[model samples]
Target chain A: MADVLLSAKDIKIRFGGVIAADGINLEVHEGENLAIIGPNGAGKTTFLNISTGYLRPQAGTVTFLGQDITAHLPRTITKLGIARAFQIPQLFLDQTVMENMLIAAASRQGYPSGFKALSRLPEASEMERLLELVGVRSYAERKARELPEGQRKLVDIALALALKPRLLLMDEPTSGVASSEKLEIMDILTAALAKEKVTSVFVEHDMDMVERYAHRVAVWNVGKIQKVGTPAEVLADPKVQQQVIGI
Target chain B: MTRRIKPITTAAVIFFLVSAVAPLFVSSWATLFALILAKGIVVLGIVLLLQAGQVSFGHAMFFAIGAYTSAFWGKYIGGGDILLYLVLGGISSTVFGLIVGLFVVRYREIFFGMLNLAFSMVLWSLLEKMFPYTNGADGIRVARPGLLGFVFTPETFQYVILYVSLLIAAAAFYGVQRYLESPLGHMLRAIKSNETRLEYLGMSARRVLLIGYVISAFLGGIGGTLVAIIQQIATPEFGFWTKSGEFVFIAILGGGAHAFGAFAGAAMFEWVRFYAAAHLADSWQLILGVVLIVIILYAPNGLIGLRQRYRQSGKRGR
Candidate 1:
């Protein structure tokens, strides 16, 4: 068995009268592409939020790298090598793409002192290289808001990669891209993640993309995981096809 | 290795030269120019906070604190040296900022602004009620401040204040410009853009803001100390909410993109008020309001933004 990099046991959270996550238990192994598939409002993103410390599960514990991290701040969790990309690109809109990358890179390097000069830093080349790896090097000097939806998604992923995390959780990596370009975007994205050897847990709705990239698939239905198995096995399950895939 | 001089550095040199030589040419406006520099320093403090997406309407409280600290030290403790009073004022304001920021940093948007206004008003009321020590609303008289150890004549005093204010303002401009180009400054801007993303990158947004708040308070204190020396008075009005509003107004007028914007805005503001009061008397504020509306409607980024746009268009034309 592969070593479990992240473990969430008995996670429960509710909002008002709605149960967002109910008694959910999940384990993500190292070096595997774990795809979380669910219908709309199935609590897939909520579960990811809990693991990344964006939301505190009302009743459960999260252990990462064998340490209890259920109550740690998102910053602390990220510093411990878990990074997240938002469903919509959460970037510094007024800043250039390179500035966004530099901010993320500089943050992981250390807490910046008042005198720590950002200009002419040795990390600029590395930032450009990261942009190049994500196939957005040409857009480096442009403002983040000026980029098209596809490029913005790539920049968002690049920003996540800048944290140098051991694990990356992406929320809808190809949701906003054109239908014709979805596969191409995923191809570049998956290639970059593989080259970096980073474990990934991505919440995606596209079954084709999941079939191509995910090693293991977890089907979430109404705040609970219905089944967890290899992509072929879970996709073939009648229950998953009827409830999640809706085909 | 040869170090390249930035345009800002060259501008600073030119500013210093002009301030030093211009005062000799127009000695009558020396005090007015000194007052502008003092207020400009305070505006620079506001600019820093504005850059971080936080606005403090109670910054005048720090200004008052600095002025009062200098007044008390000079009157009671017999420390009349200008430099010493500047240091004392800056340190006292910074310490106050550190304490207040513990609670203030948690609030954002209007709540943050209102809290600052509330604190400044509290200070204003205390200044008014504590008549015995603060001299009530009538304000207290500040003795003539000495440079180093020498007491100059009134003529020499004006020159001394001008040179000192210019030197301090120039140094602060350079320091703040450097800070804005630093990694910490980038974090500050990041805090403005998307604080959640900043945290997800493993940097504490609140901590960065606290550091900025303390530095801003220090700058406000220095400005207040210079004001006390120039005007030679410490009034409760210094801590008034309107006073704080004026700082905010200057910040908006100058824009928050560059540190020089503060001085430019202050200069234009002082000159506008000077002329408006001279010609329109009671209607000066109305004139100022119209001017601000135009600036907001046309040049939302203030004078700096206007200049940048013009430069960009000029390049395109070429």
Candidate 2:
């Protein structure tokens, strides 16, 4: 039994006519890769938002490491060792891939004031390794604006990895990726996460990806967790497939 | 143009040396050069603001604050020390900057710029209405400030001002260049690129911007102090909206690539305006307008961004 790293208890939130979260209870544990899968508007992203402090749930408490982080700002949550990657690549377009990774690494450690050169900082090599892990090392000097969508996605993931977080949350990490290329990207990302030994929670649509990469799968539907089990058991459940996977 | 034939520091050293001797060649316009260099310092600060995708059209208020600080020191404190005026000018404007930045840094883009314009206009009206203390639109006379205990005759004062302006300009250029290269400076640029990403990375974009804003206002003060010293007066016109526009104009003219670009842009801008006003006083503004349009059309990067489109530059800022 692994220790629970993040606990969301009796979480509830609503937006006008839509119920985003209704008493959603989920516990992400240490040393496990968790995949959250659901159809659109299933409150998976809203929950991720709540965890990252982008959206304050009308009701709910998010606890990380036994400390209440529900009201923390995104930056504060990041400092507490939570990092997130967006589905759409959010990057400093003018800076190079290497610079982006360096910034992410520097940001985690806390930025230095007073004329300290960024290039001379120790994060350079570490950032380069993260870039390599995500297979964007070859494009290190390429400006982020120049990278194609596929490469941008990898770089964005690399940036998240650079944060060196205790828990890493990603929103539809492979959504923009081509179906053919999704598995391969997931392989590299999961390998990097395994190497880093970071707890991972990802919202994914591809059941194949979930079955392959996720240690455990949590099926979400209409703002509620429909099922939670090992990938085989959850995917085998007829109700989850009908509701979430539409099979 | 080749981007890096010589390192920026080396080029700066050479440029400063040449500028130091420039007053001898153009002795007739020593005061003009001093004024231009001072404006360059102000534009240098604007360059930093531009990096954060923020623009202040009201920086001339800081300039006016610098000039007034010097004027008050001379009138009330009874001293003409240039060092004291410059230090006080920087400190006073920085104080104002911190106070204003606390409010303005919360906004971005047009709101940030408009708020600054609004604040400067308020200061301008205050300077105009406070006739007893401010001397109204006529302005107060700024007595010639002594430099490190030496009172130069008018004939020598121009040269002293030029040399001092040149020294301060060099230091400012170097300091700004260094600051822009630092991590904090990088984050300032990052704020422009994607503020959301910066926040998720665990830094407040507003805090970074405030730091840059205060520094920019301090530079504006420095420039204002120098201009007052050269002209021997501090007028409410110093805080006028048009004067703030000049700071923005020169910043755009120089491009935001590097600090030294501000100096080049300022020199070219002042000279063009001078000649235009001399030759065609009625439509000098028309000539300036044409030049800006041309610059915007062709060299969008300003004078410093002027280079053979290198591979290093991709799809840059929109």
Candidate 3:
């Protein structure tokens, strides 16, 4: 197996008597796409929250590249080489797609200060290249609010990728996208992640995407990882088939 | 239609020169223009705050801080150099801004405005109730400050303040326009758009807000100092809640997020009020209130947006 890039040990969280994550331990190996599949309220995103520093787990230690980042801030985690793409596509909607990329670029350059020309960043070409990688180069001049849903998801990912994260966490990359466009978004996402050689952990509901993109599958059920295996091993299980995929 | 910086700047320069020389021709309007220019600086600060979707309803506290800093300096140190007063006054307000901003920038929308209002009210009460030191409601009388080392008489002082206020207003307007095009400016817009994404990008929104707040405070302070110099006194009314309202009123009247709008709004606000008070003293407030309502309803984006709409439609017509 590849060396672990991020390890979460004994994670626990509860929100007003409802346990979101409890005694959950998972390891994401370097340079592999890990899919987390769960039903509603299973805390797949909660795990992402704890990992990304949005939520500090009540009990757990999350270490990334040998650093204990369990309760670190989201921005700190991002600066420490872990970046997240929101399921709802959090973006600077009024700004152009290229401007969004430039913001991401500016953030990486120490949260940006001074009167440096935004349109003429030194890494402007690099921003263009990243947009091209995510297939959003054509919409670079377009406002983020004007992009279609699928393109919004792609740009969100592209913005995350601009941080040059060693490990990328995505909370349902295709949640709002049309079903007809799901596979296309997944294709672009997978291709981009593969090219970037990033270790990714994504919570997904689409079995087709999970089967196609994920190297390993972790089934989350009520604050615990019930099973973890290769996609074939996990998806083939009778319980997983019944409880998760509902096949 | 396009914002060609050089032409606008040249025009602004000419406008300022005209205003500076206006006292030579139309001396009665000079003081009025001087007051407009000073308040214009304050509105520009509000414009910067507006760019980040923030409106400091209590910003007059900084204005008062600047005003008071100069008053206190004149009272204690007897420093008359205009540059010294401006520097000290701006620094004093900026320091207070940094302190207040550290707390207020953590909030958003109404909370931010209320918190700023609360702080300014505190300053206002201190100035009003503290009779021993602050001189209560009568305010502190300040001697006329000088430019360089020359003691300015009333004759030279009016021209001194008029030209100085015009110069600073032009610089601030141009600087703010330039700043709005910079990366940090874009970051301010990003904060307004989605702070969550800003953080995930490894930047804190609170930190960005604090910086903007500090800059706004600095501008407000400078404006206060200029106005105080022109008035030759610092009063509790400087930090009053309604005074802050007037700043917001001017900001909206001028424009939202457009630097030029702030100046235009200040000019219109002062000139209209000055003339209307003389002619229609009983109903001037009513007329201005009606004007604000109309602007909010029809031109909600403010003057700049109105101008842009006309220009774009004119092009379409062509």
Q: Which candidate is the best by DockQ?
A: 3
Worst 10 residues of 3 chain B by lDDT: B1-10
Clashing pairs for model 1 are: none
**Residue pairs that clash (backbone atoms under 3 angstroms), model 2:** none
Per-candidate TM-score against the hidden true structure: 0.96, 0.96, 0.96
Tens-digit lDDT track of model 3 for B86-158: 9998899899999999999999999999999999999999999998888999999888987888886687678
* lDDT: worst 10-residue window of model 2 chain A: A111-120
Candidate 1 versus truth, CA RMSD in Å, comes to 2.4
Native interface contact recovery, all models: 0.84, 0.81, 0.88
DockQ of each: 0.71, 0.78, 0.79
Interface RMSD over true interface Cα atoms for each candidate: 1.3, 1.1, 1.1
The list of candidate 3 runs beyond 4 A from truth reads: B1-18, B312-318
How big is the positional error of residue A93 in model 1, measured in Å on the Cα after superposition? 0.7
lDDT of 3 by residue, A102-157 (tens): 98998898856667778888978999999998888999988999999899999999
Report residue B90 deviation for candidate 3 (angstroms): 0.5
Candidate 2, B1-318: lDDT as tens digits: 123524545655776776777778888678878888899999998999999999998989999999999998888878778899999999999999999999999999999999999999999999999998888999888999888999999989999999999989988998998888778888889999999999999999999899999999999999999999999999999999899898889888878877877887898798888899999988888988988898888778876656624323444632
* Residue-level lDDT tens digits of model 1 in A1-247: 9899999999999888778789999999999999999988889999889988889999999999999999999999999999998889999998889889988888988776656567566789998998999899999988898999999999999999999888999999999889998998889989899988889999999999999999999999988999999999999999899888987
lDDT of candidates 1 onward, in order: 0.87, 0.88, 0.88
Model 1 Cα lDDT, one tens digit per residue, B253-272: 87778887788778778778
